[model samples]
Structure formats: C-alpha cells, structure tokens
Target: MSQNKKQKGKFKQKLTDKYRLVVLNEDTFEERFSLKLSRLNVFVLGGFFSIVLMGLTFSVVAFTPIKNYIPGYSSTILKANAINATLKADSLKVQLAILENYTKALRPVLTGELAPEEIDSLVLQQERRIIDESRLNATKEDSLFREMVELSDRFPLVSNMESNVKLVFFAPVSGQISQEFDPSVKHYAVDILANIGAPVKAIADGTVIFSGWTTETGYVLILKHSNNFISVYKHNGNLLKEASDLVQSGEAIASVGSTGKLTTGPHLHFELWSDGYAVDPVKYIDFK
Candidate 1:
C-alpha cells in the first residue's frame, strides 16, 4: 500500500512540472509556445546584464567632467563689464551725434558773410556763449556719467590754449621741507615751511581737478595734465584755483602753510602722480 501511494505522488509531480508556462508575446500571436530553460541559460543571461550595467556606469563617468567647457572662456566680471560698456558707448554715441549737429548748425551761422567787424563781434559773442554752455553741459554730464563711462573713452577736447603740462616754483621762498617724496613707503609730497605766506606755482599746464581741504591734506590742489599725470599741492595756506579752473605752468596756485594733520610746521607739501602711482617728484623737479 505504501509503494502504491509513492507511485501516485511521483506521477502528480511529473504532471505539474511538464505543464508550467510563461508568456513573452501575448499580444502579437495567440499561438501557444513553450520553453524549458536550464540553470546554464539563466547564468548566461545574468552575465550579459552585468556587462551592460558596467558599460553604462563607465560611460556616465567619462562624460560628466566634459560638460563644463564652453562658458569658461571669459570670466563673469569681464562679460558683465563688456555688456555695460557697450550700452554706455552706444548712448554716448547718440549724445555725441546731437552735440555734433548743434555745432554744425552754429558753424554755418558763424561762417556767414556779415561785415568783418559785425561778424567778428556777433560770432565771437555767440561762440563764447555757446562754448560756455557746452562747458557747463560737459561738467554736468561728467558728474552724472563719469563712473558709467570711465572705461569708454576720454572726452573730446577743443580749446584755444595749449595743455597745462608743468608746475614749478616761483621766486625761491625759504622753507624747511617737512615732508618729501618717498617712493619706498608711497608718500609723494615735498612739505616746505614759510612764516605765513609763500607763492605756489603750477608745475604743469593742467585743468584744476580739485582744490579743497580734507581731513588729511588740507587746502589741497590737484591738477590733471597731459601724459596721464597729476600734480598735487597740499597743506596750503590759501588755494587760488577752484575745481575745473584751467592753469598754466608756473601759474600761482596756492600759498605755503600747514593745514593738514601730517604737518610738521607751516609748509607746502607737493607731490606728482602718474596713472594712480606716486612717482618721485625729485625725478621731475629741481628744488633749486
């Protein structure tokens, strides 16, 4: 009886194993299909999957670092500056065009043939007034738009006088130099002593850039000249030129006295700078 039962169980197991199925293409065909995959087939398929996965990981790693190449040509600061400067230059061109038209219109009126004396008087007066207006507009525009256009270009200059390019001393007034131009430590000034007053002359032809008193350099006078250079006269008893005043070489600019914090006595401290660098005044000056 036990053997008969065992034979029946074996027959059931065989039937169950033979009739098992899987569907790979249920939509395409209704025809029935069967497969008997062994352990070796499963192992081969798993190895292929592992190889494909490794290839995918390698590809991802290789391409990741190469994505950042295009925008690295110029720095962010440069790009922004280029954009802003271009816009400003365009605006300036428009402004310049308007100015040019006004000048052109005036040119014809000035060149009209009135009598020499009549034309001279009228043209001179009109030109002077127009020049004054242009100058005022230039000042206003400079104050309003300097920072925006510093990198764009220099203002177009038209003047009767030559450029202020030198500043020197008048009759030698005796004074002890309290401060001298020292290149090693970046101090650029010659401080001279006087009793109450001494004449300060323009070292070069230049427009008065600044003439005022500060906490450090009191009663200062800064002159901007050609060759991208500036001459500074500091610690003055009196300042003669206002800001934007044109000055000639050897023109009186100030008086000698102590008015700033770094004063040893009542003296004049003079300096020369080029392109924001304080150069040795002795190189371009003769104390005698």
Candidate 2:
C-alpha cells in the first residue's frame, strides 16, 4: 500500500506542476509577457482550438459556393442549362417534322401538276345521280296482274355504313375530268386528261401494295391507305415509288401517261376502293 501511494503521488505531481512562459525585452532586461501554465492546461487548450478550426472548415464547404468544387458536387446553373438544352432539341425535332409535312403537301401545287383551286370547288359541287325510274313504270293491266313483292331491299340499311364526305382526299392529278365513274358500265374510275409527264400525287399517307406494269392498265401504282381505303393510279408514264414503299400525302408517285391499250390519250385513270367495294372517286377526291 505505501509503494502504490508513492507512485500515484508522483504521477499527479507531474501533471499539476506549473511552468513559467516568459518573454523579456532584449535591451532593458524587463519582463514583457508572462504566463503560469500546467501540462494539463496546455493539452486542454490545444484540443479546444483544433475543434474550433475544424468547425470553421465545415461551415465554408456547407454554406458557400466552394462546395461545388468538391468531387461529386455540381453547380445549379450547369444543371439548369443542361435541362434547357435537352428540351430545345426535342422541340426542334417536332418543328422539323411539321415543316416536312407542309412541304410535301405543297409540291404538286408548285409544280403545276394540278390546279390548286380545284379541291375547294369540287367540295362545293353537290353529289347528284340521275336514276332512270322508267323501268318502274307499269301499264294498268300489268300493274293489276303484277304479284305483290316485299320492298325490303328498296329502303335498305344504308344508315350503318360509313360516310366518306368528312375524309380529306388529295387530288391525284390536275386536268379536265374526261370520264366519270359509271357503275352501270363497270367503270369505277375517273379518266383525267392531262399533258404528258404531269406529276401524279398520292392522295394520302399509304404503302404501295402494287406497283408494276399490267396488260390492261399499263404502268399501275396502287396505294393502300388507312380506314380500309385503296387508291389505284393506272396509265402512268413511269412509277416513281415501288411496292412496299411508304408514301406521304401529296407525294409524287407517278407521272401521267397513256400506256394502256384502253386509253386514247395521255391521261390518268384513278380508282378508289372502300371496304371490299369500289366507290366513286369524284365523291371523295378532287381530280380537277
């Protein structure tokens, strides 16, 4: 117990021992600044100052723009500029697509392939068909002897069919329409007489399902459009696009020519098919 108490006393004394830190004026030999410090006091003061310095460093990086210089940090302006550039690029692409579509629509008009005003005038012309009802006329004796027939098919179910009036169809050619659609004669197309080499335009966006020379129609190009509509341009001078080629509205797909044995002069024979049946092109398209 005595030896242990002696060792403890020596250790405590070493830590509590005071020392003088003094500075003297060189010439006068007088003390200028003096401090009485212990070993324990020196250690505590050094630790406190180190902690304060570290706190200041942390504040600078956390609250000031200098933080952006760190390895993983980014500035606000740089991020905002990046976002703006990406958005601008997307918007420019959309604008370019619209311009391309407009140019395609205006090609035929600028090249004088078709008259521009014909489309507007054709829409104004009301569709009319004269039916010869003379076949319905019956003599008095024949009418009395005629058996009563149910007129079920007379007022047919025409209400459920789709109407093509609202659909926008481009003029396939610009010329005087020579022959109109006559279902009675099995002629389901219109013959437009135009000068040679006149550009023939696609009526709408479609794919060329048939583009080849035929014995009956000569050089023919057929496009299949949406909503089960198909367009046939026959008697063409040449085919610009081939089968399976994608075409936009008003794009040039052929030229006017009388290549078939059936045509008499340079003209375009255009046909429009809806569902499985053939429809009148005059009712849907404006071929001048």
Candidate 3:
C-alpha cells in the first residue's frame, strides 16, 4: 500500500479550520450591511414632519375646542368630580354656616355686597376651578388622541360622544335645605346649602333677562317664564348665561356660592315670582 502524508504550506494555517472567506459582489457573498445616519438628518426628517401639520392647531386662527368636547363624556366626568368635591365642601360649609349665622361679621351677600378683597378671593377660586376643569378635559383629549393614533394603523369611527338633552330638572346640583320659601317677609326663595362653585338651575324654560355680578349678589340670574312667572337665582359662584340669552328649563344657570348679603355658607337662594309677587318653588317641582 502507498502511504500519503499532508504537505506544509509557506503560509501559516488558520486555527479555525471551518472558516470561509467572503467578499462583496462575490457569487457566495453573505454579510449584513449597516450604516449610521447623522443626527440632523434623523431629526429633520424623522421627527420634524409632524411640526408643519395643519388641522386644529398651528393656524393663525383657531376654533373653539368645544367642537372636540365629548359632551357628557369628559365634562360629565369632570363635573362628577367637581360635584363630589362640592358636596364635601358643602358639608364643611354646613358646619361653617352654623358659625356664620351667629357671626354678624360673616356678612350676608344676598342682602349686601362683597368687598374687593372678597371678590378677588372668589375670582381666584373660580379661575382655579376653570383650570382644573381644563386640565381634566385635556387628559380626556390626550386619551382620545392616543386612541386616534392607534386607529391610524387601521380604520375606526368617530372618537367622541355626542351631546343631547335628556332630562329636565327644576334645579341643578344637589344640596341641603337652608331656608324655606316665605311670602310674608318677601323671602320668596328656597335656600340650598352648597360649596362655592356648585351649579344652579332654572326652574322653568324662559329667556334670561339678567345675568351679571352685583355687590348684593356675587352673581345673579333671572329667567322670565310665560304666564307672568319669573325665576331668580342668586349668590352664584359663576354664571352660565348672559342677559337676553334664551335658556332651557333645568339648564344650568350658575354655580352655587356665597356672594350676597343674605348668604352664610355657599348656597343657592332660589326664588320664584308670579305677577310681581314671591312664590314657593316647592309648589311645582319635585325635589331631586
């Protein structure tokens, strides 16, 4: 038998015996190509495309976001939170009212006027509520935006809910009884205890004859109904309607608060007038 032996080469042998050589554009070439882009190009192209977008914002003029308001969806949630807070605040006010009635210095806003300092405090609180509502509304908007983003990968219906009037109430927010309607002393309204910023409602459908702030009443709303009936709302934290505005019955007219001479804790002094005389609200509407 003939014996065969391996021959040594002039070059060094590779330790990796299974190694294979590779070259670009070669028949058997196999390698991953990679590249790193500059930051400027990536920023300008990848991230800046959303900057020049035209739609709701970035325009010279803007429409009210009321178009985007999801009606009872976001605002309801906000109002619910606000109402709960208002209720708790009213509980505190209930405690304060007992002390307030005894303290002549407390000043009745219904029959009197508030000073500049008091008005400033009220305005600040209103602004704070508006801000909180805005923030909460923004959160809802953000959530809607995220949903839109997810839907962008496919197709989806409208992302917001609609607003339609459902029920009509004789009042707005809930509260406690303070004073009963009295025609003898000309106390024509029923007082309900509430924290400053609680809402007030119209007793019936009518046009708003007056809506403004006064020294005697921090805020006031008067509705003129048919059959010579007039509804007056006083000591509001804020007003929803303006003079000569048409409003529906059960529509929110204002927020409950103590701003008038007759007020102690935050409460709504609701009055009904018929043929130039004070009447009781309890006669027509059922309590909530």
Candidate 4:
C-alpha cells in the first residue's frame, strides 16, 4: 500500500511540474517573452482550443450557406428545382395520356374503319371500364343531391349540372339543311348547303383536337368541348385552327366547301357527338 501511494504522488508531481516557454533575441541574448505552464494546464488549454475550433466549424456548416459547398450536401435551390421538375414531368404525363385517348377515340371517325354501331359499343365499353376502375363511392346524401339536381334541371334552357352541364350551341353557319341526321340509313350528320368560302364557326367553346385533311372528308376540324361533347366539321375549304388550339363559341374555324368525295356541292357536313354517340346537331343548333 505504501509503495502504491508513493507512485501516485510521483505521478501527480509530474503532472503539476512547471515549464517555461521563452522567446529570445539571438544577438542580444535577451528574453523577449516568457510563459509559465504546467503539464495539466497545457493539456487543458489544448483540449479547450480543440473543442472551440470544432464548435466553430460545426456552426459554420450548420447555419451558413457554406454547407452547400461541402460534400454530400445539396443546395436549397437545387432541391426546389428538382421538386418542380418532378411536378412538371407528372403533369406532362397526364396531358400525354389525355391526348392519346382523344386520338384513339377519333381514329375510327377519321379512318371510317369501324361501323357506327361498333364505335358506339366501343365507347360504351370504355366508359364501363372507367367506371369499374374507379374506387370512389358516393355517400347516400351525395346520391340524393345528385338526383335532386338532375330532376330540377330536367327541362331547363341552361342546365348547370356538375360534370354534365348542358351547353348552348351556336349556329355554325347560316344555311338550309339539305340532308338531315338519319341514323337508320347510317347518316349521323346533317349536310347544310352554304355559299363557298363562307365562314364556318365553332358550335361551342372547345379545344381543337383534330385539324387535318382526309381523302374522304377533305379538311376536317374536330373540337372537344366540356361534358364529353365533340363537334366535327367536314368538307371545309380551309381550316383556321390547328390541333390543340382553343376556339370560342361562334368563332370562325373554317370556310364552307364541298371538297370531300361524299359532298355533292358547296355545303358543310356537321356532326355532334355526346359521350361518344353521334347526336343530331339540329336538335341543339339552328343553322338559320
């Protein structure tokens, strides 16, 4: 026990031993400065300085923009830009999907490859598939509200139902109807005789989904409106709008012409479709 105590005393003495740090002038042999320090004091001062340096480094990295320059760190601006890019990409994907569906639905109309009956069935099947895929379930209150609205607007001039608002169509052209809509004979459109180069207007506000020339229809312009309504203008001498263009109601979108092979003279072949089934344009529009 005595030997251990003596060893402890010697260790303590070594830690408490003083040392002098001196700076001297070489030529004059004069001490310019001196500092007295013990071993324990030197160790404490070194550790304190090291801790202070670490804290300063941490503050600079954590609180200042300099952290962006360090490895494995990203700038706030870069993060925001990445988020915006992702959102835009998602939006573009949705638009591309809508365009693709429009093209697919209009393909048979443009090509005349499918019968009208077959097209109607195809559209019905697509609608059924969409309904089946949707997982939304309306409450009883919602169903009752919808039924009330439908009943109230059953015979109104301007129906304002959500998702199925009744649209008021404008006269596409002032002319006499030469041929009426007769589905029994597979004639789903009306032929209106008009003067050549007369302005052909849009029936409603919509986006031009198709504007191109076909061998059977000549310059055909198709517009997609709200509530799943589509209007097709055929045998136009010239198209004033292009695909993806927005047109207002009664806006001149084409010129009257009997340019198609099926046309007999200067006239306009106008067709209206609702939820993919061809409807009589005369029921909703008065050309005169």
Give the Cα lDDT of each candidate. 0.69, 0.85, 0.67, 0.88
Backbone clashes counted, model 2:
0
lDDT of 1 by residue, 194-262 (tens): 776778888767899898989887798899987877888877888888999999877888887788787
Candidate 3, residues 136-234, lDDT tens digits: the string is 355777899987786776543432311112222366556777788754454667887877776677766789999888888678888898778788888
Number of the top candidate by TM-score? 4
For lDDT, the strongest prediction is: 4
TM-score of each: 0.40, 0.43, 0.40, 0.47
> Which prediction has more favorable TM-score, 1 or 2?
2
Write one digit per residue (lDDT tens) for candidate 4, span 1-288.
999999999999999999999999999979999999999998999999999999999999999988988998888789999999999999999999999999997897889988899878987676542222134467899999978886876574344443243467888998899999876576889999999999999988999999999998899999999889999999999999999999999899999998878778899999998887787788788788
Native-to-model Cα distance after best TM-score fit, residue 104 in candidate 2, in Å: 57
lDDT over C-alpha atoms for residue 53 of model 3 = 60
* Candidate 4 Cα outliers beyond 4 Å, as residue runs: 1-166
